[model samples]
Target chain A: MQPQRIAVVGAGAVGSYFGMRLAEAGHDVRFLMRRDYDAVKSGGLHLSSHLGDLSLEAATVERTPEALAAHGPVDWVLVGLKATAIPDIPKLVGPLLSEGTRVLAIMNGLSVDEEIAAELPAGTSLFGGLGFIGVIRGEPGQILHQEFGAINLGHHGDDPHELQRGVDLFAGSKVEIRPEASLLKARWEKLCWNIPFNGLCVIAGGVPVDQVIEDPPLYDAAHELIKEIVAAGNADLEAHGQSARIDGPRIAHLFLTQTLGMGAYRPSTVIDYNNGRPLELDAIFRQPVQRASQLGIGVPMMSMVASLVGKLGERVE
Target chain B: MQPQRIAVVGAGAVGSYFGMRLAEAGHDVRFLMRRDYDAVKSGGLHLSSHLGDLSLEAATVERTPEALAAHGPVDWVLVGLKATAIPDIPKLVGPLLSEGTRVLAIMNGLSVDEEIAAELPAGTSLFGGLGFIGVIRGEPGQILHQEFGAINLGHHGDDPHELQRGVDLFAGSKVEIRPEASLLKARWEKLCWNIPFNGLCVIAGGVPVDQVIEDPPLYDAAHELIKEIVAAGNADLEAHGQSARIDGPRIAHLFLTQTLGMGAYRPSTVIDYNNGRPLELDAIFRQPVQRASQLGIGVPMMSMVASLVGKLGERVE
Candidate 1:
């Protein structure tokens, strides 16, 4: 495959990690950054990973999306901002999109691709990239990639070729990408982990994943949340005419069992909460909870987490 | 009321305040102290209240129940310890209990009187004293009374006169005591406030009652919790052959409205959590959540709070 040109928008930890990997694979990658723009422009971007360390001393840093677009439309624009910043997708991502430009949204939360797609030009190829890893943004221009560098790639757009393109971008990198036939199912699978871990971590006094896994009630609450979310996800899948149904109890057991080994992994939501930054409430909680409600699914754990996470988020403002 | 003989068990802040008052009013009130025994014995006890300041320089500090019994069985025994300490009820309150002695349980949570009664001798006159005040134990031997020192007193025994006897004990004191015909309803009424505020405060990152009131989802969650608890209470009351039933929406509105003026009021549970002390889980959340489950009521929010609070409680251990 020929080398690709990629523009990374909202290049936070996850975005920066993937874009850096893609760029290291000989793809021409440019980052549209703000907070870390100066640091990245001068010191360049660095990813300290368990698997390996990677750094770009002469990384390209574009101050604005307009500046990023001026370099010409990239093959793919990676929308890696927090779900809370999804609303700014149009202004930040719109300028970087050409008619053929595909998007690989590397953000957590449900219906984010749809949200980003709705705001951008119609029929644009939007691929949902759910990153399953422990990564955090450190002192400017640095990514602390703790473990599990894997991506669940699913296409939300009509272009079937977009899925292959999404997979190809990470083909030569150390990062493993698993392409899914159903984006909805992949997102829901991610929710099984995110809704419980992210929500419980913040709601249960901003503790880490191990705390949620260790505390029986919280651990039980986590499973209850997973059960509720899985059921809702299955119901929504059915409603959307997809034959993708999640097995609730099994998924709960799997995620919780996996979490037991996660040690003290702090989900990004807890990090955001402890830092008093805005949470991805709508994309992660409110949207899913609302969808569950619309489907007449009773999501008490989901609802509780949503409101509590919502309240926790408001503590910053 | 000729200066009654009173023994205060679990004399924390609330116990110290009321005991100091009774002692000031010319009654013989001895406190069975543990943590604050030496300080109280040396420096006496103090009550810094909004209504007025009160102190007892010569406060009686009994090291043990047997030591307390040496002064003879008091007319009334005030149990003001945290509900978590209720298992020691028999050992702590037994020495001070005579056939004629009336017991006043000044603790929070569901069926505390019943639990205490079960642990004590049968046919004993028991009273439930639900205190509505913002009081916290500060420095040893000190009581920080923020506002509203009122106790809803209700007889929980076969003796009809026990309520009046309980009322007369606090009659001359500055602390107001309102007698209720039904102890169950009164306790339920108190739960209307405690379940939501206490549970939500700790669960939502050790925030105050105001945050629970101010945040929309938390505010809504608080109401949802109140409704679940109130329904469970009503059902339990009916099952117990009581005619009392709580009007859910009205009570919810009243408590939430009341909380708006309670700026930054940290509930005792939140305080216990922040201090890493064992929470009054069995008395406050588990017992009630269990009772609700037994009644076949769906208490998602209540269950979530119970498990989270339970987990949060275990964090200290």
Candidate 2:
């Protein structure tokens, strides 16, 4: 496959790490840095992964999307910003997009691609990616990748050719890319883990995921949250005229078992909360909660969890 | 009303404060001190109340119920220990009770009188009191009473004369006594306030009642907890062949409104949780949750709150 030119937006842990991975795979990848802009600009971006370390030169780092756009139309625009930053999608991506540039929103929450798609020109190839990874932003210019860098890639548009390209972009990288048939389905599946762990870690007093697992009521809420997400997801899939239904019990059991092995690892939201940064509540909790409610699913714990997490944020705002 | 001889079992904030009030009213109030046994026995028991300050002599403080019982059978035994201490009632009160001695359980949580009465000799006069006040243990020998000091007295058995005698005991004190006609109904009413405030305070990260109110999701859980308690209480009343029902909507509104006025007051459970003392989970949360579940009501939030609060306790235990 030809090395494609790619631009990375919201280059936090997810974006920077993946972008650096694809860069090592020989893609022409450049990052849009904000908080780490100065550090990365001077020292370049670094990804410390157990899989292998990768480094990008200072020339590959840009402070603004307009500066990143100077290279002209790229083959793909990879969005790794928080769902909370979705509103900035248009202005941020507009200067970086070409008529043929495919946008991949590798975000945690639901409907991110749709939101990004709405911001772009019509017929702009778009897709979604859900990274199941344990990674966090270290100091400026570095991302510490602990484990699992697999992304479930699914196209939002009807272009099968572009979806394959989304997978092929990570071909030689350590990150495994599983191209999914349905973006909505994959997003909901990710939410089965995200909503509970992310929201609960913050709600359970900034504890790690394993602390939540050890705590029975929190564990119960986590199980219920997963079950509700699966139910809501399956209902959503059926509503979207899709045939496959995500299994609720299996997902609950699986997530609970998986969470027990998290071994006191804190989720991203808790990290964000501890650092006093804005959470990705809208995409992660609010959107999914709204969809579940609309589907007539009973989501009392999930709703309460969302509201409580939102309260934690609304205090400052 | 003539001065009555009374023994105060559990000289924490509620017990010591109210006991001191009754002592000032000329009642011969003797107290059983545990944690503060040495300090109180040496320096005497003190109540610093906004209403008025009262202090008891060293002679009035006893280290054990046996020592308290040594003064012959008291006319009244005020069981002010937490519901978590219910199991000890038999051993503690057994030495304090005489045939004519009536037990007034001024404790929080459900079915205290029943639990006490069951452990006592058959036909032991047992009644319950619910104190609506703001009080806390300040030091070894002192209790800080910040606000209201009122007791809602009700007989667990069918004894009108004993109930009035219970009321008359607090006749000259600052503590206003409102003798409720039904213990069950009064317990349920108190629960409308207790279930939400106490449980939520602990579950909301050991914050005050006011903080729980300000937090939307915690507040939502609080409101839902109150609603579930009201429904459960009403159901329990009906199941027990009582004609009257505790109004759910009214209780919810009244408690939520009243809670907002609490002004950062931390409930007892939160205090216990912070102090590493046992919470009154079995009586306050577990019993009510079980009863509610048995009544075919959906108490998801209430149930979860109970489990979470319980988890907060179970960690150390």
Candidate 3:
């Protein structure tokens, strides 16, 4: 397989890990990060795991669009910021989007492809990628790879084969790309787990995973939330004349079991709250519940949880 | 009338305010304090207000039971600890509870009187009192007196004439006592306002009254919480063969309006949180909710708010 050129935008945890892994595999990769741009430029890139620590001395790191244009057009742009940060991307790097340049939003929540595609150039291919990683910024130049480091890739509209080419490019990287024929199923399944766990963990003040692992209220809430997301997703799929693929309830239970097995991994939202960063409450929770409302699906549990968390976020002074 | 001999326990804020006032009124008052005895002895007791700043140049303040008893046996003991601190009083100064002594527990929430009564000896009378004073230790010896300083006194389960005598003693001092014949109503009415505003302010990062005065959901939530407390209090009243006095819904509105008018006053829970002291969650919130369950009253809104706030308290590291 030919080595593909990749750009890892907002290279914090998930981006740094995946980018370094792909670069280590001898693919052409560059990290576009805000904080570690200086350190990463000096040190190339560093990725550390409990398994082993690998430093990519030859990988490129840059901060601005001018720097990226100097390296020329990339084949894949792994957009890794929170969904709320999606609107700011075009303003950040209008020069980075060349013809055939695929922007894969490797973030949480649902319908991110539509969000990204609406802003990109007309001929630009939009890809939706769901990352299943528990990576944290261990230090300025290192990402602590935690649990469930995998990715699911699918196209926005009717095409699945085109999305696979982007998925296959990430095949030999540290992250797994599980290419699904149904993008709707893939997106819904990720949202099913992300909304409850992230929103609850953040709102409940980063209570340990074991605290909610066996707890019936939390588990039940997660299951109920997923059901609501599934109902809403199905409504969207039906409106778009497409078939829903994921079994939301079953996926919820499986995720709960996985949570029990995962052994004390803090959810992304929890980490964000602990670090005093802006939470993705709007994207993962509010937007999903809003979409559910649009579909006339009652989501009392998620809505309540979202409301509490959203309000709590406002008070994070 | 001759000034009644008085003993004030837990000389912080309310206790110190009442103690100094009683001492100034020519009553032989002894303050039984744990921490600030040495400071008060060195600097003397200072109470600052717009009305006037008063000082007790030669006041009786003691840390130990033996030192407190040196001032002679008292007719009345005004206990003014935060509700959670009530359990510790029995062990701290058991010598203060003498025969035929009336113990006015000027603390917040329900069960404080019961907790004290359980520890009291036979022939000891107990009273319930609530103070709407915003007093804090300004320094080692000085107490800052903010606005709306008033006291409400009544008997929990005692003779009205005896309760009036207790009220008369406080009235002789600068502290104005709003004598409620039914103490149960006074206690419940305070709880109604407290459970909502205090818990909400503390949990929502100590939101001062001005923030939520105009907001509908917050104001509504406060109203709902107070109503539930009223329901629980009414049930408690019925179980104990007493008549409920205060109107919950009406008082909730009054409390909200008063808080809004005050503008700068933060609830006691917020002060505790800011001072890095343990919050009164178990006493102020959980205990009442447990009692509500025992009384077979449905307090759904208050329960959720309590759980949410309790969770917030649990996160305070």
Candidate 4:
């Protein structure tokens, strides 16, 4: 396949990492960023990982969506923007998308699909994405990917073939893209595992997961709470007839292990909190809570967690 | 009746206020304190309020429990020790309780009575106390009453007649003993009001009461949580078959008003949290939560607050 031109939106850790790798692999990649542009222009987007530090000297870094139009059209637009930044999506991405352009959203919440679907040009191909890389910003125009995995992508609708061109583009590089059997199921499965653990760690100021898991009462409460998220997500997926599937105990075990394994790394919510940056609390916590409420699932712990993190975000403002 | 000789334990705010008042009224008084004696012996004790400042040159201060014996026995002992120093209660009052030395506890929380009761000699009069004065250590051997109101003291258990001496001794002073049908109810009432507001304000690094109360959802939750406390307290009283006469709605109203009126006065918990001092978390919050659980009352919000505060305490430590 000819190397497709890609515009990576919100060039923070994850977006920058994938963009850098694609550019290094000789694909035409452009990073859409604001403050990071000067640094990227100077250093050409250096990425350090446990694997190795890689630099993308050929990648073009642009500041605005209008500037991306100046570079002409792109085949794919990958959005890794923070959910709080979603309201600005239509404004930011409008100039970059054509009718044939595929939009892939890799974020940490259940609302990413709806948010992107609302902002993108009508009839544009939509590929749902979830990135499992443990990435952090090392400096301006520099990021650290401590762990690497396939950037999972799925077609938003029942047509599995909808995302083959974009998937092939990523497969041509070092990144992997698995066609999800059911995108809704995949999204909810991610939510079932991600939201509770993230919320818990962030609100408790990132107490080591091992320590929290040791406490039987908190542990049990957490498991039940995660199950609530799972149930809610499953219900939502089932409503769409998207074949909901989540191994509850396995996900719980994974949460415990991941927490213990990465005890030192601050979660994304904690990072946002520490940086005085706007958090994706509404998208990540409140949106799911609203969904659970709509489905009439009693998610007491989820609601409590949402309220606390929401109040915390409000206090920061 | 002869002027009752009073022993003031922990010559801090509450102790010095009442102790100095009684001493000025021509009642014999001795203060049992650690560093208070040296300061008092050198310059006497300075008592200041909006009313006036008095240098009590005649008031004696003892540095230790043993020194209290050297100063001679007294008829009444007012224990004003910090709840953190509760373990020293027995030793502080040991020298003063020769025969009829009645004990009055003017501290935060409900465990003070049980803590001191276990240590007091059998047949000695025991009374519960609540001070409405907002006082603190102004300087060495100096106490300042920022806000002044009448005190409440009465017997906790049987023998309502046991508090007459307290009433008589506090005569002519601002201290007024409310003849409560049950002192335990009064203590619990104070605890119910203190836990949420105090902990929230303190843990937010001394954000004044107004900040927490001004927060819409938090303010409402705080008000409701206090009602839960009142309900829990009543349950406790009913379990003992004591009079559960505290008006929950009225108390909640008083607390909301108190928070608004406090303006910039940071609660002691906030001060302690800021200074890395040992917090009264377990005493004020955890104890009540435990009590609630024993009573089979659901206090999810209170328990969450307690857990968060407990975690904050651990972080600062």
Q: CA lDDT of B285 in candidate 2?
A: 85
Task: Give the per-residue lDDT of model 4 (tens digit) for A66-128.
Answer: 987789799888888888888888888888988688788788788678777877777878887
Query: Against the true structure, whose TM-score is highest?
Result: 3
Query: Model 2 over residues A1-317: C-alpha lDDT tens digits?
Result: 79999999988888888888888888899888889989988888788888988777654877889988987678889999888788898889989987788888888888888888778899988889889889988888888998678998998953578888887778887789988888888889899998888877776566778867886656777887888888889999999998867778877887788788878688888888888888887889899989988999877778878876776666424
C-alpha RMSD (angstroms) for model 3: 4.5
Worst 10 contiguous positions by lDDT, candidate 1 chain A: A157-166
Please, what are the lDDT tens digits per residue for candidate 3 over residues B1-317? Answer: 47777888878888888788778778888887767777888778888986578998767888886678777887888888787776677765578667777788888877777777787775577888788878888777888898777888878675788887877786656788898877877877888777877876765556665555445546666776777888888888888787655676588778877877877677888788667677788778888888888988987666665665666676664
lDDT of 2 at A178: 89
lDDT tens digits by residue: candidate 4, B1-317: 57878888878778888888888777888887676667888888997787667788756777777777787777888888778878877667776788777888878886677777888887778887777666778778888777645676657574666767667777776555565557778888887667777766654445667766775545766786788888888898888887666789898988787776766666767767777877777778888889889999877667766776777677767
Model 2 chain B: weakest 10-residue lDDT segment is B308-317
Query: Ten consecutive residues with minimal summed lDDT in candidate 3 chain B?
Result: B208-217
TM-score of each: 0.74, 0.74, 0.81, 0.75
DockQ scores for all predicted structures: 0.34, 0.23, 0.20, 0.18
1 or 2, greater by DockQ? 1
Model 1 lDDT per residue over B57-163, tens place: 87878899999899886888888988878789888998888878878888888989888888878887888888888888889988898867789888885245777
- Tens-digit per-residue lDDT, B1-317, candidate 2: 88889898977788888888888888888888889989877788777878977777654777788888887779888888888778898888889888788888888777777888888889878889999998988878878887677898898874788888887888778889988877887898898788878876766567678777876656777777777788888888888887767777887888788788879798888888888888888888888888887888777667777766766677535
Pull out the clashing pairs in model 2: none
CAPRI category for model 4: incorrect
Using lDDT, give the best candidate's number.
1
Q: In candidate 4, how many clashes are counted?
A: 0
Q: Identify the runs in model 1 with alpha carbons over 4 angstroms from their true place.
A: A38-43, A66-73, A241-243, B5-105, B109-128, B132-164, B167-193, B206-266, B271-304, B310-317
